[model samples]
Target chain A: MKNIFERNVSGMTERLSRSVIGIAGCGGIGSSAAVSLVRAGVGKLIIADHDRVEPSNLNRQYFFFGDIGEKKTAALRERLLQINPDCVIEAYDKKLEREDLASIFENADILIEAFDKAESKQWLIEEWASVFPERPVISGNGLAGYGDFASLRIRKTGNIYFCGDGKSSDASGLCSARVAVVANMQANLAIELIMNKTGDVK
Target chain B: MGKITVNGHEIDWNDNMTVRNVLDRMKYSFRMLVIKVNGTIVKREDWETFPVPEGADVKVIHLMSGG
Candidate 1:
């Protein structure tokens, strides 16, 4: 395992291979971010979602036709392992409840909020922060419609870090290209935090 | 008695000004927002009750994406 990762990846091998990330919601953002982190050599991931893939998810989510009936967390775990066979993935087959966050994601170095509903997004963020005040929560918001790619951005409030234009409502429409951009940005920020976390070499 | 700032703009602050009141004053009807008052996060459920004192620095982030 070490030999394969050594050959495939370059810098921060020791750090990434030991890190653990937690993600809530297995939609486009969560699915894509998990893949990118695994490719970047993140050692473990804990993903959860209560929904099953439907034909509609193909528009932006990272799932195949065969994954249509599979639960999102289960399907995503399979996909992540396919990329890094040794990478540890703990997939829960249910939506996250506020009370389950600390116990489920206690070891997560960082948390990602990828839910679609406005209320869900707000609820998870605040709940997670209340439980893990020291950890950061990366969120995706406002990547909807067309020709306003610049509308998407990143913002930080205390322990909460979010990415979006803060104006684009997904209810109106969500473009694949824009969603991918924000997903990658969230993944990139996660990498940055892990790499720059001041002596986190475990 | 004094005023508070929201996203760099000054708004008149009054007694018993909660986070919800500020949102209404600013006309921020967006559903996905990350609000903070003086660097302290104000949860969505607490919007109606979280206090925003005079001269408090508030951040009302308007989130644009859903998933």
Candidate 2:
């Protein structure tokens, strides 16, 4: 039988199939990143979020209309499993706290900080970096508003890879296109970091 | 005049010019921002008092939403 990932000619599928990626948050960025990772053949994922799907999320978040009112982690898990039934997914439908960090991210090779709140992002980066200094963390920041897609780019600071324009305001509002662009950037960077190992890609 | 680099642009700096002053002078009104001075992150509470010395490198990163 022809494998679904046979078209992954770069040999990344094989390597990705053995890696476990962790995502914190399940909104627009988290959901989009999760879907992309699963489709890219990543074998394992650990996702945590306390949010529930709402009608407003349908504009950008990766959830169906029927998924409204469902826990984001649970809904996303269902969608991801449909993408790759063989992929191992661990979904936690609760707010992730410092106490749960170790057990939740123990096996993940990389951590994706997909939070929306500024304070949450700061705490996640600080805690995750302090706890897992060696693990690469791909984070999204300043990805609100619309247009200016060219400004969105990847920036590496220490072990954290920030993907976005680094300028948009929280009050500027958000659109689906820009959110997905940043999320996909985070996903793509995660794959590159996973494959390259050194994370020295220029 | 002494100068400091902010977000890659060199701007004139004066003695005792704090992060808050710099943001005000630069017209950066974003509420959610990460200010780094000389490679050190300045906490939100210290924005008004954290001094940006001459020749220091500063990066003001704005944090936004969408997931």
Cα lDDT, model 2, residue A103: 86
Chain A TM-score, structure 1:
0.94
Off by over 4 Å in 2: A198-202, B1-60
Model 2 chain B: worst 10 consecutive residues (lDDT sum): B58-67
If chain B of candidate 1 is superposed on the true chain B, what is its TM-score? 0.93
Candidate 1: lDDT over CA atoms?
A: 0.85
* lDDT at position A186, candidate 1: 92
* Candidate maximizing DockQ: 1
Question: What are the lDDT scores of the predictions, listed in order?
Answer: 0.85, 0.85
**lDDT at A63, model 1:** 95
Output the lDDT of residue A176, model 1: 72
Chain A only: TM-score per candidate: 0.94, 0.95
